[model samples]
Target: MTSPLDSRQILRRQLRQARKNLSNHAQLIAAQTLVARVDHYLSGQQTDKLKKVALYLANDGEISPHLLCEYFWQQSIATYLPVIQGKQLGFARYTADSMWQENSYGIKEPVTADYAPSRDLDLVFLPLVGFDSQGGRLGMGGGFYDRTFANKRPDASPQLIGLAHECQQVKSLPVESWDVPLQAIITPQQSILVS
Candidate 1:
């Protein structure tokens, strides 16, 4: 029998591999479809005050949000990428001409001194290894997003949304004490609003 922590680890590994197995063409289609789904979801919400938004560059098999970034750019909404600031995440504005530096994990981060804390952003789209319909998210086990947004509530200003491939959906996930609940989860096929 697997303990809850062990179960989570197993689920993480399985889901990570499931997504990682997607062909490059399939991944491209999923990303393109995601932009439409995300746009539709946001259109039905009150996004009048959205200014700064946070999203991640796709790593591993995480669905890319580059197209969604372009959608935001067209609307004049600034996008940011997470910078590893100690144990938590600091968001740096990402622009077409932004310079880059590699983080410890070899992920490229925007080379900028102007880092914004989580509270200032209007919306945040997170990358996940697995997610449940009830807003449970299994991250890369780094806990960066959890630590960065731990103090925020579901109805907080920076609405947390997890983005994933359809293959990453699970029946449920073991919720830990430190796990921060997402306000919603978005995939190429569906958008789940956590109530």
Candidate 2:
């Protein structure tokens, strides 16, 4: 029998392969599915009470946040995006037509002058490559998100939510000490409330 660590490695490799094999159309459908599910969640909740939110632009094989952005924008809620500066991240308000330039990794981000870090954000939506039922998240091997959350004040922690496809779910995942678990995970299939 394979050990848990070995199984995790195998599952990670298989997940990567499956994502790579997805056609553009299929990826769009998957993203739409997840977006609809998330929209349903938001529709049932009150957006006015949510003063601030952190969102990530979709990349790699993650579900697209384009529709999600429209929903939040329509509600007139404040939306923020992560800007990587070295090993740290600063959250910046992002509009549908926010001016963005590619970072070193080719990820688009808002210009520094437009950034407004919020320590009192009500929620944060994170992108995940893989996640478990308990909210263990695996990012793109970059610790930027983890480091950002680490810097949050103990009394001002934002509600962290991981966004991903249903296929990204695994039985378990390996986590490091510095890794901060999410409050919930939203997938194409269902929304998992970890706390």
Candidate 3:
């Protein structure tokens, strides 16, 4: 029998490969579709409270939220990017003029002192390798998001949303206790809300 850890690792590898195999055209279309879905969701929410948002720069073929960020900026919403802060994670405000520095993982991050505490943001969007219908998210084996958002309480200000390509969804995820479930997972196909 495969342990949960082993199962998760295998699933991650498969999903990562699936995403990386997307052609440039497919990726571009998927990203545009996802942005449209997110835009529709926000407009239908009936509130202007989701102004401050945190999201990551796409890496390893993960679905890109760059379009979403651009839309938010146009709408006057503040955009933030995650920074690797020691063993955990922190967020730095991102703008068109923000200077970017590459982290050890070769991912670009903002190196700035102006960072908001995680609890202050209205919404956080995370990239997922694999996700299930019930909100289980399999990340890149780095516990950054989970560790950073560990203190997220019920009805918190930052509603966690997982961003992924349609091919990344799985039947169900093998989740552990420490795994932080997402409030919603958005793909090019649809946006699923999980309780």
**All candidates: TM-score:** 0.96, 0.85, 0.96
lDDT of 3 by residue, 20-81 (tens): 99998988898899888998767768447766899899999998898989988988989999
**Residue 154 lDDT in candidate 1:** 74
Name the runs in model 3 displaced over 4 angstroms: none
**Global Cα RMSD, each model:** 1.1, 2.9, 1.1
> Per-model C-alpha lDDT, please?
0.91, 0.78, 0.88
For model 1 the local lDDT of residue 70 reads: 94
Candidate 2 ranges beyond 4 A from true positions: 1-13, 43-45, 151-155
In candidate 2 the C-alpha lDDT for residue 73 amounts to 79
Q: List the residue pairs that clash in candidate 1.
A: none
Q: Relative to the unseen true structure, what is the C-alpha lDDT of residue 181 in candidate 2, on a scale of 0 to 100?
A: 75
Ranking by TM-score: 1, 3, 2
Q: How good is model 2 by TM-score?
A: 0.85
Residue pairs in clash, model 3: none
Each candidate's clash count: 0, 0, 0
> For model 3, what is the alpha-carbon lDDT of residue 108?
96
- Model 1 scores a TM of 0.96
